[model samples]
Target: MKIKMKKFGVLLFAFLGLVSCSDDDDANVDPPFEGQSKSYDLTEVGESGVSGTATFDENEDGSVTITLDLDGTSEGVMHPAHIHFNSAAEGGEIALSLEPVDGDTGISETTVEMLDDKETEISFEDLMDFDGYINVHASADDLETLVAQTDIGGNALTGESVSYDLAEVDVEGVSGTATFYERENGETLVELDLEGTTEGNSHPAHIHMGSVEDAPGDIAITLTSVDGASGMSFTNVAMTDGTDDEEGTAVSYEDLIAYDGYINVHASADNLATLAAQGNIGANATEE
Candidate 1:
């Protein structure tokens, strides 16, 4: 009976020690927080054809991790990504630098204990108060050009889809369709699809001030030139009255609906004087 009692006590002590270690492990584990994540859907900027999502995660180690999953970039190209101060519409300055995004996978993962120019660690709660945005540049060499971006905590775009039909001007059998998509970021993406165009030629296209009545009054916004082989052009509208000095125009989508305009597709870049095709757009536009 004594031998049996001593064996039973030893077993009980081992069990208690195991339980104490288990409790210690449990105490070190971090609790899950339901509202510790923030997600933002990014969009294309400056005709870069890039779009993606940025997710910010608050880790248990007091560090914030940001993951960016993107698309519409060439493989093997590296892009510079950063957190900027203020909204995208306001063209904010970079506040925090992040790891360069890889083009092959289009993924950027970065962690932050604080901003690049700051010293103190920033909490997840305090980061929510950050009046900032994220902007992905074309590359390390071209930081001024933005490819994909989004406002962190700002108003989104809710607008309409508008399209127009083009007719042959001086060039026969040259025509196209121009579609304007109002993006969630309040920018307009104009895509031109043309047919019966010369295979080796490039067509310069633009949004003009007038319609059939005016016959290309003035160039309002320059568009991406259409490739002859694909007969397609995709550009973000910058209604700046076709000036070399103007950065961007003040024209909004609301103003576009009430403005009179048209589209002009030229035969070549050097031959802007000759129009291959033209279309009435905006207030005078005809929908099909």
Candidate 2:
């Protein structure tokens, strides 16, 4: 009886030891991660018809995982992609390279802990404030042809915008709208969309110093020439064109919304006197 009782006590001690070890192990284990994510729309470039969403996922380990899921991608073609260091309208050099998207699946995933230089550490938070844009090329050979693109981070549009009507001046039926879009970085994107522009002609557009009610003034800023074929022009405005006393002076979206200026679209570069469209913007804009 004494030996049996001693064995039973030894068994109880082992059981308690096992329970203590289990509790210690549970205490040392790390908890599951709860992180955040952001998604940006990737618009189709030109007529490529490929568009999708780019998602940046924050990992518990402080890395960023970028996933691109696209539609309308051609099978058997590997598309190259990169993060460029500026607004899409104002193109800049590549800041980071991503994995080539598999055309068959129309998907790509990359875990980025640092920039392309491999020295600049980029966390998920850093990417949210990055001044960059993403471009997915058609293929390795056709780098100039973009399949999908989006302005991310600071260059993304803030959804605050103002538009002014560009009425026909010298040309009949040549008129459109000039829109100023606010960027997240406080810059502005000036877009000119016109109608009835002659095909194969490029129209010079500019922001003059004064309103149209006043006499024509000197150019305050130069804008991208309107493409007659597409009847579109996109210019990223960060500063004055340095044409006046405030040459290369810094400008913001806030400044332009209250600016005393007018926009003019000429018939062509050579015929500045022949206006295709004209419009008063900012403080001079009519309530209508």
**Model 1 over residues 89-195: C-alpha lDDT tens digits?**
44567788888889999999998998887886777766666666788989889887889987663323344777788888888888988877665445566779899
Error of 1 at 98 (Å): 4.6
Tens-digit lDDT string for candidate 2 (182-261): 99889999999999997899999999988998957988899999999989999999998764354588999999999999
Cα lDDT for residue 169, candidate 1: 85
**Which portions of model 2 miss their true places by more than 4 Å?**
1-32, 243-247
Candidate 1 residue 6 C-alpha distance from true site, Å? 51
Candidate 2 pairs with clashing backbones: 242-247, 242-248
Question: For model 2, what is the alpha-carbon lDDT of residue 260?
Answer: 94
TM-score on alpha carbons, each prediction: 0.55, 0.87
Best by lDDT: 2
Model 2 whole-model lDDT (C-alpha atoms): 0.94
